[model samples]
Target: MQRIFANRARTPEGWLQDVIVSVEDGQIASIQAGQTPQPQDRRVDILLPSLGNLHSHSFQRAMAGMTEVRAAGKDSFWTWRTLMYRFMEHITPEQYEAIAALVFMEMLEAGYASVGEFHYVHHQPGGTRFETMTELSDRVFAAALKTGIGLTHLPVLYTYGGAGEQPLSGGQTRFGNTVDSFAELVTQARAHASRILPGDARVGIAPHSLRATSPRDLAEALMLKDEAPVHIHISEQPKEVADIQTWLGARPVEWLLNNAPVDTSWCLIHATHMTDKETRDMARSGAVAGLCPITEANLGDGPYNGPTFLAEGGAYGVGSDSNVRIALTEELRTLEYSQRLRDLQRNVMIPGEGSVGAAIYLDAARGGAQALGRQAGHISIGNLADLVALDGADTALCAVEGDQLLDALVFAADDNVVTDVWSAGRHMVRNGRHLEREQIVSSYTRAIRSLIDAI
Candidate 1:
């Protein structure tokens, strides 16, 4: 058991002062406000319910800066994807595990208590089968174990290369699996996760996208989803939207909403190209819009339909998709900044006149937990202890309290303000660093050197 005495803390009821949070068995046992700090209590200035990164490809953290250089002609998501496929060919299981450990550690240090790793890279190079079917999945679990970050392991089903049953090519060969094989893989992944991961960890399913799987296969995959979270890449690029529309009868979001039972359990990643109606319908559907603002801007993916979605009370969360950058405050800042850039207005994320920082931060926390199917997103009793502590004395945050303090966090502060982080009661980060930072960084440096040399 542990007790955290916070000078200020954000609860579902709103911000409270002099709060003491008790944790037992990885859950918040109780929250007592107006309490004095005891000798045994861990002391913090500002505490928040940390958000989960709802979407990530942990292996891609290794290729962050490699794709920034311009190609022969115009650079787009497609061209970048081709390069990503090539780069992924050189990652061995050990290196993959090493990369994931670094990514997870960085996430914890960035104040993200958990991650929904949309893992798709499955096989050995050249589509050769590894002796162990869940080789890469177990490696991801191992990384999670080492980092002590909450894991929502999403084993993706990448059946085809494109819309209308296109053939698998290049590095995609590693991700291809028949529906039956993918189901078996999910079962094995679940067993491995239960065997190796903490109780709060979950295993979910990701059907790569409409372009990568047929409707029949998608339906079958969803049947295997049970009650777990389901994530899909949808309408990230105009070309993707057009291709999916040309192949299917309607646009990607429209088709999914019309055909699938997309409800609260679904997270539609990048729904950036939706029409107003599609956006409103998606909001009404109770599905989360898994927005990765930095990655969207980096890849030239268009802005999301924030106005219509928010007007309809949509659920949404943020992620460091490609991990080109991994700062929690920056992710929230970039999200609001993208809205401002698109509409040429300030304070656009909030519904009326409240603090946009508090609104986005709380909404993203709740929506991210919903998307990952984790019982978190609040500093309340019985919730998982997914929490972060910030240095209120930081120059960027010292002058404020309540919502304005959150505003300072989103608009002015860097992740360096994060002083401590707990994922399911595991205090993996302390004083702005992961507990095993040196070993993780050394392993990543060696793995990245080999990968670069190979490429």
Candidate 2:
């Protein structure tokens, strides 16, 4: 058992002063405000419930800055993906573990306690299945264990290169798995996941995208998922949407809404090109919109319809998809900024109403936790103690209090403002750096350098 004191702690209801939190067996044992700190209690200035990244491709961290150059003609997501496919070719299982360690550690430093890794690369080179089908997944789980970061491992079932069950092509060869093969992988993955982190690690199913999984195959994959959360990439690219329409007779979201049971258990990533009705229908379905604003902007995908989506009461969360960058606050900042750039107004995430920071922080935490199928997203008693603390002395938060403090932290403060993080009560990050950062980064640098040299 351990105790921590927060001079100010943000709870779901509101902020509390001089609060004491107790942890036992990696869950919050109790929480009460107006309590004197015990001599053994760890004290913090400001604390908040940490958010989980709803989507990530951890290997893409290795290729963060490699694809920014303009193509000879028509630069877009497909062009960017061609480069991504090429890069994934060089990542061995050993390299995947090394890169994912650094990526997860950085997420801890940036105040994300958990990540929903949208993992897809499941084979050896040239479309050959590995002798052990879940080898890459084992590597990723090892990285999560090495870093003490919570893992929601979404082993993606990517069977085709495009809509209509197209054969695997180019770099995508490594990501293919037949539905029967995928079921075995998921079964082994769940058994493997249970051995680590006990109740905290979740293994969800991802059907890559509309292009990668046909409607019939998607339904079959969902059967393998049981009651676990389901996530899928949908409508991130205009061309992809057009292609799905050509094959499925409807837009990506439209087709899914018509064919699948997309309810609260689903997370539709990058529903970026939805029509007004699609947006409203999606919001009403109680599924989360897994918005990755930084990656979308980086890839030139247009902004999501935030106003219409929210007005229709949608659940949404921000992700570091592609992981080109990994800053929790920066994701929230970019999400709101993208909305502002579209609507040409400030505070686009909220209207003339509540605190934007509180709304973004709370909403994302709730939706992300839901999508990850975890008992997280709060500091209440019996909840997993996934928490983050800010540096009170940071100049960016000078004299800020209550929701305004959240405003400064989310919009003004740099990443260093997050001084400590706990994933399921494990203090993996302290003073704005992961405890194993040096070793993790060293391994990552060596692995990336080897890949770069090969290229």
Candidate 3:
């Protein structure tokens, strides 16, 4: 058993001082406030429940800066995606693993304790399968183990290249899979994760998006879904929404709500474009809106309907989609700022009154844990000990207390203010640095060098 003594810690009931939290076998055993710290206790100034990155494509981290060039015409998400597909085709399995390790390490340092890796790259270039079908998934697990971050491995089932059941072509060929094969892949991934990853690690399914899978394929994929999470991309781009509406005869969110079992177990990634009706209905559906503000901004995806969604009691969580920038504070900051910029108002995330930072931060912690099927979110007993500690001494967080501390974290500080992090009691980060950062970064540098040469 290990103990953490925090001068101030956020609990489910409220903020408490001089808190002592005990961890036994990765689960939080007890939390007592106004307690004396033992000599062996790990100490920190400010402790908060670390947020999970609810969506990611870890392999895309390597291509972050390469996509920023303006295309010949007006650059759009589709054009950015075409370049992404071409870049991914050159990534070998070893390079993919290296890139995942670097991304996971970066996530830990960025105060994201766990990640919902929406893995889609499966086959070799030209749609050829490896002798081991689970090669890429195993690579993800290996990277997770190397980094000691909590893993929710979401194996993506991408059946088609585009809307209307378009056949797989070009770079998308790597992600194609039949329903039966996808089921087997999920099964094998579950077994692989169980064997190697920690007890809290999970295997989930992602049916790519409404555009990538037909109704029949999606239904069959959902049939393969077990008790774990089910995520899907939806309504990120105007073109995507228009295409989905034209092909399916309804908008993406509308069709999913009417067609599938859209519930709390589902995390709809990037429901950015939606009607007023679709927003309210989706909020009422109990599914998490997995927002990736940084990537959305990078790809020119529009802002989500924040006010309407929150008014309807919607749940939302932040993610570093595309792994473009993996800063948790910036993600939350961008989310609130997006709302502010859109509505032309201040402190827009909370419904009535209170700190906007605390509202979004705590809600994201809970929603992210729920989305990844992780028993964490609160600093409470019986939950997994997924936690982060901030340096109160930092200039950005100095002289702040209560909700102001969170406000500073979201609005003022960078990820450098994150001093320590634990994912399910695995203390992989200390003093704002992941323990294995040097080696992981070296491997990634080598991989990226080789990948650049290959491309």
Candidate 4:
């Protein structure tokens, strides 16, 4: 149990001054604003509910700057993927866990209290299942445990190579499994998750994409869905949309909405290219648009219809997808900047209900919590105790109050403005750094060196 008072705290009813938030048993016990600070209260100048990152490939953290060099001909997501496959083909289990630990730590330090890891690198280098099915799953669990980031383990189901049931090609063999094997894999993964994370972690199903499985097997993947949230990569590239239309007679989002039970329990990753109807229909379907702007820009994926989507009442959350760059302010900034560039205007994601910065953060928080199926994204009573305190003296937050503070932080912060973070009542970062940063970096350097040498 703990009590912390903030000079200004972003509560459900807007920012409140001189607020005391109580945490007990890893949940927000109570929030009392307009009160004098107690002698024992941990006090800060500014506090806000931490954001949850809704999509990630933790191992890709290693390949962050390695993919910058261009191939001989035209470069695109497909070409970059070829290099990714080559880079990952030699990663040992030790390297996988090490890289993931580094990534999870970076996320915590960046003010993200939770992550939905879209894990797919299963089996060994030669496409053979480990004697222990939860071997790599254990890596994700161990990384989360070491870092204190809330875990939403989305173990992916990757069966085929492309549309039309294409055979698993080289470098994709390790990610393949039959329906029966995947079920067994998920069952064992859950058993391990229960032991490691208990009720705090989510073990959800990720059907890699429409191209990774046939329509028939998609049903099998959804059968493993249970009550957990469903996340699928869809329509990220124009080529993917065309292939889906050619193969299924409908675009990816259109086909899924028509065929599957996509509701509030689903997150559609990178629905980059969509018609106005698709945007409206997606908003009405209650699915979260898991937008990863930095990764999209890194891969040259086209801008999404952000203005239309939000106007139609869509839910959205940002992610550190490729781990190329992980920063809370940067992700939010990039999201809005991309929209601004597309629309040739500013303040594009601002909601009528809140300030531009507060609106985006709140929406991302709620939508991220929805996608992760976690009791988080709020600094209110009975919600998970995940909070971040900004450096009140930082240039971005020094002179602002209420909504303007967030606006400045989002648009003006030059460095990490977050000073501290607590996930589920455990403080993992303070003074803008994770507690175990040095050790994590040591492990990451060793692991990355080994992988680079192997490559």
RMSD in angstroms, candidate 3? 0.7
| Model 1: lDDT of residue 68 | 87
The window of 10 residues in a row where model 2 has the poorest summed lDDT is 346-355
- Candidate 2 lDDT score at position 322: 94
Q: Residues 267-362, candidate 2, lDDT per residue (tens digit)? A: 999999999999999999999999999999999999999989889889988899999999888899899999888889988786449889888888
TM-score of every model versus the real structure: 0.99, 0.98, 0.99, 0.98
Sort the predicted structures by lDDT, highest score first: 1, 3, 2, 4
Candidate lDDT (C-alpha), each: 0.95, 0.90, 0.94, 0.89
Give me candidate 2's TM-score against the actual structure. Answer: 0.98
Give the alpha carbon lDDT tens digit for every residue of 1-455 in model 4. Answer: 88988888987888788889999988999998898988998777788998889999998999999899988999999999998998889998899999999999999988898999999999897698887887998988998988989999998889999987899988899899888888988888888898878467899999999999888888988999889989999889999999999999999999999999999999999999888899989999999999999999999998889888888899999898999988888889899999989989988896564678888888898999899998988787899988988887887678887788888988888438887888888789988889999999999999999889999
- Candidate 4 overall lDDT versus native: 0.89
Q: What is the Cα-based lDDT of residue 132 in candidate 1?
A: 93
- The sequence of per-residue lDDT tens digits that candidate 3 reaches over residues 1-455 is 99999999999898999999999999999899999988999999999999999999999999988988888989899899899999999999999999999999999999989999999999999989988999999999999999999999999999998999889999999999999999999999998888889999999899999999999999999987788999999999988889998999999999999999999999999999999999999999999999999999988898999889999999989999998888888999999998889989999999889998899999999999999999999888899999999999999989889999999999999999988999999999998999999999999999999999999
The lDDT, on a scale of 0 to 1, for candidate 3 is 0.94
Give lDDT: candidate 1, residue 437: 98
- For residues 390-412, write the lDDT of model 1, one tens digit per residue: 99999999899889998999999
Which 10-residue window in model 1 sums to the lowest lDDT? Answer: 347-356
* Clashes per model (N, Cα, C within 3 A): 0, 0, 0, 0
Model 2: pairs clashing at backbone N, Cα or C within 3 Å? none
Error of 3 at 125 (Å): 0.2
Better-scoring candidate (lDDT), 1 or 4: 1
Candidate 3 residue pairs in backbone clash: none
